[model samples]
Target: MNQVIRGLSVTTFFYMVTLWASFALFHAIFDKPFDHDWDLSGNFIGLFMVSVPYIAYGLILRHLENRPVRRAVQVSLLTVVCERVSIYWIGSYFAANGYGNPIPLQFIRGEAAPYFSIPYIFIGGIVSVLLCVAAAGVRWRKS
Candidate 1:
């Protein structure tokens, strides 16, 4: 029980920090606010931020002592929910503060997630699951 909570908390923290740090990096490098507009740099940063956290999360779970494979997968799915909601909340925060375009927030809030980002989310989830599975497979082969 404690382990599951710790896993979720750590991964979610990674997700949030990664998201914020990417935006900060974009603003620093481009000298402009990140407004959810996918200019060339934005596209790369956005995709990288969306996908890397899941990989990191899966790796963390894989290395955690005594973490079961099933629990790892479950926590990965939960992070998807966390990611989507964070997008909405964080985008809204940016919009409200005049740091971003509200158009993206309108689309996200109306539909529960930006339509364009859904595929990336699934890809991240799939990668996370694959990492978990591969870790278990290696253990099984040794036994």
Candidate 2:
């Protein structure tokens, strides 16, 4: 019980930090902030892509040390799916209330926007995985 709570807390914190850093990176490099509107679904999708691996890393740490790799992967994938569902629910809540100063839906045209494109999401995921793996390796070596 305690372990699970600790794992979740650590995972959530890491994921949020990574998300913010990725947003900042995009802002710095692309000279644009992450959009707060759904017409830019690509951006939100990209954020999710970047987030899942970090969440998986936390689950892997909690359950993988003594378990088979296959089992660990399965559990990690499940954790990612659960996190995505929760994110969707939260997004819907915010959208319903016009939170984050979302642009009116009526104003959005159907053209696919470049904000939060797939490539950025993939880059974020790769960077996150590398960072998490490196951190874990360092901790292991220290101990």
Candidate 3:
């Protein structure tokens, strides 16, 4: 349990660092703040940004004496829950600060439900973990 918690902390730290750095780089190149919802490319990059942490998390836990699939599922569930909560909180903060919600307008307008995106995220997490496992050649058998 403690190991999972520690792994999550490290994963989250990397995610934030990568996110901020990506934003900074985009700003430097474009001479403007990156609006994550302003274009399709932004959304694609956002998805990639979210996936990278899951891959890292899987790699971090690969050495545990457990099944790879189990570890992968853990990484998926933890990341998805955290990601959803973080999005909601950030959107709320932006809205409260008069910057407007960062969440897509479709969600706010009832054209799409935010919760519906969970399955896609979960699928992405599974794929990311599997990629890490394959790339690292992590053994599934318990030690």
Candidate 4:
């Protein structure tokens, strides 16, 4: 139980930091460079691409910790959903459960959601995790 809580803390904190860095880079490189339309979907998709290896790294660490390989993979995949949800709504949740008129939710609900095109982030999150696992499996087979 304690280990799970610690693991969740580590994953959440690591992901949040990476997410901020990613958003900063994306904002600077895309949003400000040409001053074109801010493509929030592009940022979200690109971040998922960037996050894959980090997700794999966490899974590998879990493996190193003597958790079963399958369990590590399973939890890592679940963490993808967790990470995405946190990215999307953590600020709003902190503000006041969507009743307090959160500023962050404006970007999240207004910009990101409509920009995503795909109606379900959960599906995308699962697919991203599967891609990471597939890559890891192939690498393990080769080495």
Candidate 5:
């Protein structure tokens, strides 16, 4: 229990820091916020998205400590891609139904419009994979 709490705390801290850093970089480069809506729903979704990479890297680091960097990177990338796809599917459902408070799907569409579009799934997936890989690197160094 103590270990779980510690892991979650560390993961959450890293996730938020990395997410904000990424957002800041994107904002500086594009002159626009990585995400526009700062409401409860939007914040929740952002939390979830950021946590995905941290959790993925944490789990891999926990179970596959002996794995080589190439293999670890591959697994982490796959995990992030899968997670992003699942999130997109859930987002699509919410968008279609007009459900949830303010709806995270709408925020995804509004802020990550280019990335969320049909033609950009691969690009987004690659970017997510890279982000996860980088997060894994940070976790590895910290541990």
Candidate 6:
């Protein structure tokens, strides 16, 4: 129980730090910084970009450590959810912000994840599941 709480805490901390770091990176790179906006908040888009799939993958990995097969099922269901929500998020972000809409199925390199399309979410879930699977597979293999 304590370990689970610790894991979640660590994940959240990592997520937050990542957000801040990304904001910094954006400010450093782009002349027009975005984290300040409300309707088209870079922070908000970034939250979905980094955190949603990150947390989902983390949860899947945690479950995989305890129960591999069950976690796979969980990952599958999560993939579905990620696929839809992520697609919508990307579409809305691009539509409103006029940038960064191309995030396609990233499991395979060079695939285009177009805005307002199913593939955006599909990529989100695919990337998450692939990361979890690869990590868990390596760990389980070592054990």
> What lDDT does candidate 4 reach at residue 71?
44
**Backbone clashes (count) for model 3:** 0
lDDT digits (tens) for residues 1-143 of candidate 4: 55546555665666666555665666675665312343564455455544654465555554455543444466556666675666566655644555444666445544443223234365566665565455434434344
Better of 2 and 6 by lDDT: 2
- Indicate the TM-score of model 1: 0.59
Query: Between the candidate structures 4 and 6, which one is better when assessed by lDDT?
Result: 4
Model 5 poorest ten-residue lDDT run:
111-120
Highest TM-score: give the candidate number. Answer: 3
Top-down lDDT ranking: 1, 3, 4, 5, 2, 6
Global CA lDDT computed for model 2: 0.48
Best lDDT among the predictions, by candidate number: 1
Q: After superposition, how far is residue 94 of candidate 3 from its true place, in Å?
A: 5.4
lDDT of 5 at 138: 50
Task: Give all candidates' CA lDDT scores.
Answer: 0.60, 0.48, 0.56, 0.52, 0.51, 0.46
Error of 3 at 138 (Å): 4.8
In model 3, which runs have C-alpha deviations exceeding 4 angstroms?
64-66, 93-143
Per-residue alpha-carbon lDDT of candidate 3 for residues 33-88, written as tens digits (9 for 90 to 100): 44433453354445656567666766666665356557566655676677666665
Give the per-residue lDDT digits (tens) of candidate 6, residues 1-143. 45445444544555456546655655576645552443343334444543454554555565546764345445444544644665555555554554542433221111222122333345644654555445444443354
- Clashing pairs for predicted structure model 4, backbone only: none
Pairing residues by index, what is the TM-score of model 6? 0.40
The alpha-carbon root-mean-square deviation between model 3 and the true structure, to one decimal in Å, is: 6.1
Q: How much is the lDDT of residue 105 in candidate 3?
A: 39
Better model by lDDT: candidate 3 vs candidate 4? 3
TM-score, ranked from best to worst: 3, 1, 4, 2, 5, 6
